[model samples]
Target: MFLFKKNKDLLEQYTKYLELCAETLDIFRKAIAYSFENGLNEHFEVLAGKVHAMESDADDIRRQIERTMYEQSLLPESREDLLDIIERIDMVPNCADHLATLMTLQRTPINPALKSEIMELLDLAIESFKYTKEAAVDCFLKMEKVKGLKILIDNNESLGDKLEHKMIRTVFAENTGTGEKIIQKDMINQVGEICNLCEHVMDRIVICSIKRQL
Candidate 1:
């Protein structure tokens, strides 16, 4: 009975860790949006600080989940699988962290047209994250749902790449200073990377579904 309870606690902590992924993504989403809108000012700094805090919180939850899993004495396969998934889930927030930190350094003001395009890209990336959370849930309770989500997440990934390319060209085409253009290009890359990482996580999830069925 005690072992069972311990295992149950680990499961609960895993769920909490999953929840933190969504939270971290949301914080990053807002921080990125604010940076685009406000141009990495003090307000943007405050938002970035929130992203930092959430990433730290997620880290704590991840460690707890790992330790609890180790102590609970689950089957080797099950423990390893959880660890793999959790590690991938952990990567999703890192994209956010990178974006929040990297963009603040650009500090170059965005023109209206480019800002609109970048906002669209950010929106699509956020949408991809929503799909990731959905895929994570379906992976846990309803593996059947994962296959369909894979298609959607893949499509989102493709869209994100196209937007990234378009924005990079847009950044270069703008009549900005050399340094500013370079910074904007890097910012665009970071924004697109968030979606790529989300797809990366979902791809692993789809495989986990297949493994579950096999």
Candidate 2:
């Protein structure tokens, strides 16, 4: 019974961890949008700081969850699977934090012309993370909605890839200087990487779901 209670508590921690990640991503979207519209300004820095703080909070919770699992003496395999899932989920925020840092530190100059496409890609990346979060939540809570989520995530990721390529091609085609073009391309790749990371985490979520069924 104590073990059961510990598992329940751990699951609750996981839920909180997921919530923090979602909040971090939300702040990231706002930060990027503000930067795009207003350029790197004071407000953008505040938002980026919030992203970093929330990511740190999520990491703390993950550590707590790990400690609880060990104390409860969960089977080694079960512990490993749970650890893997949480670690992957944590990366969502880590990626958001890294992207925010890249933009904030470098003050990467985004071409005005590419704003529309770049914002579109950002939307897709956030949406991908949303589905990834839901799928993960479903798995932990045994909500049985994991089915078909992988396909949805994959489809969005596919669209993101196409959009990324289109944007890069557009970047190179521009009459901008080579250095500017390279910076723009790097920015695009970082945003696209968020989408790719979502898909990668979803892959693990799906595998965990399958293992649960077995």
Best by TM-score: 2
Compose the digit string of candidate 2's lDDT tens values, residues 62-136.
Answer: 999889888887877677877898888887788889888887898875677778887898888888888888887
Q: What global local distance difference test value does model 2 have?
A: 0.82
Q: Which portions of model 1 show Cα errors greater than 4 Å? A: 1-7, 105-112
Candidate 1 has its poorest 10 consecutive residues by lDDT at: 1-10
Candidate 1 lDDT tens digits, 1-214: 1223345577577667777777877777677666566666898888888887888898899898778877765777666766787787787788778767766665554445567667777778778877887777667564667877778888988888888888878878888898888777777777788788888888788777777677
Task: Tell me the TM-score of model 1.
Answer: 0.87
The candidate that wins on lDDT is 2
Residue 8 lDDT in model 2? Answer: 76
Instruction: List the candidate 2 regions with Cα displacement exceeding 4 Å.
Output: 1-6
